[model samples]
Target: MKYIALFRGINVGGNRKVDMKQLRTLFESLGFSQVSTYINSGNILFESELDTKSVLMKIQNCFHNTFDFEIPTIVKTENEMKKIAKSIPEEWQNDPTQRTDVAYLFPEADSKKIIEELPLKIEFLEIRYIKGAIFWNIKRENVNKSQLAKLISHKLYKSMTIRNVNTARFLAGEKE
Candidate 1:
């Protein structure tokens, strides 16, 4: 199955500097095929027979052993991506600018509970869950300043990558 591994805190603020080539090598060494790293932010797309949990554990362990540091990782398969893409709330789609942010949640995440705990003033926040993934659409200028994004890192306890609606669609290979 094709999977995307999103790593947190890599190549950010000059801290965890991992070259894409090394990242690809690490994934390939773990038996994944067609390993590709995107945007230098630790987004890796590859194919592996192992399930998501096992893949996560393997990748995390490899990263820890190779880099000597722990970085949260979130794994999602291609099917999961399709489900998340289809689940973008209709209401949010009506106002594109109001829904400029897209967050891809881990397959094991409990989105309902997380949604319920969001801070107020989120303004037009919408979440859809299907096929073991959660898709969040939020209208916000700075994702970091958004309450939903701020709380997600704590709630999921896994690495997360927030792309603008454009980047999310691009990663998902959805037509603009």
Candidate 2:
């Protein structure tokens, strides 16, 4: 299946650096084909016959063996990703210019738990849980400033990755 693997803590601040070449090689070792990376921050798109969880574990193992590190990897199938895109809050959709982000959550999370505890200090930013991901309508000013970002990381227990709305759109196959 075609899937997007969102890797955490790679190529950040020059630490945990992973070259796109080696990244592609790791995935290829796992028997994934058509592998491609976007930007420098470990947004990988590839196809594999393994299940999502196994894919995650295999990548994690490969990372540890190759780089001596354990990086969190979240894998989502193309269909599930489509559901996530559809789950974005309507208000955010109407105003694309607003600074926004999408936090991809673990597939097994309890949605109700997240909704109840969402941070609300940032008025312009809101969160929606669709399928297994959190779609955030982050105000541009509040994008990097809001407590919601921290809340998401905390609430999700660092099992998620926050990518800018534009990047998310591109990964989701939306036109610029």
Model 1 bad stretches (over 4 Å): 89-96, 106-109, 127-160
In model 1, what lDDT does residue 33 have? 99
**lDDT by residue for model 1 (1-176), tens:** 89988777788889978899988988899999988877887788899989988999998788778886777777888766656665665455426356544555555564555555555344545565454444566555534455654564475545245655555555566644
Give the alpha-carbon lDDT of every model: 0.67, 0.74
The residue-by-residue lDDT of candidate 2 on 1-176, one tens digit each, is 89998887789899988899888887898899999999999899999888988988888788778887778888888787767776665456425457566777765563656655665564656766675677667656666666654574455556567787667777777634
Clashing pairs in 2: none
Listed per model in order, the count of residue pairs whose N, CA or C atoms clash below 3 Å is: 0, 0
- Determine which window of 10 residues in candidate 1 has minimal summed lDDT: 89-98
